[model samples]
Target: MNAPDDTLEFTGGLVARLPEPADFGIALAEGFARRIGDLSRRAGAPAAAARWAARAAFAA
Candidate 1:
């Protein structure tokens, strides 16, 4: 997936090292949110998905 200009890309090699489907899903979700956060910052929108990621971290 393409990361925003402000963010580093999530490399395929790194994703390949994930251990399981659930873990992969969470990582993918978080990574996507991080990219969104970068985009939001650029556009002056709210980082709502980053809040979701924060809640997810507390749930972990």
Candidate 2:
């Protein structure tokens, strides 16, 4: 995914935008979450899917 071009203006007039590295990290985390959730459900642990998905995402 492409990083947004929008910038945040600070009190001192400093402009900040989402860095490419951070954007990629966020995308990866999202992918991990989805995959973990799917795997958990497929293993017949739907009840714990959300919890495990969260753990996997953060542990990455």
| Candidate of highest TM-score | 2
In model 2, the runs with Cα more than 4 Å from the true position are: 2-19
How well is each residue in 1-60 modelled by candidate 1, as lDDT tens digits?
332243223233344455666456646655665655566566765666555544444234
Q: Each candidate's lDDT (Cα)?
A: 0.49, 0.50
- Per-model TM-score, in order, reads 0.41, 0.50
What local lDDT score does residue 22 receive in model 2, on the 0 to 100 scale?
60
For 1-60, candidate 2 gives per-residue lDDT tens digits of: 553342111111112234656656654555565566667777778656665664566457
The TM-score that candidate 2 achieves is: 0.50
Model 1 stretches with alpha carbons more than 4 Å out: 1-19, 46-60
Best by lDDT: 2
Clashes of each: 0, 0
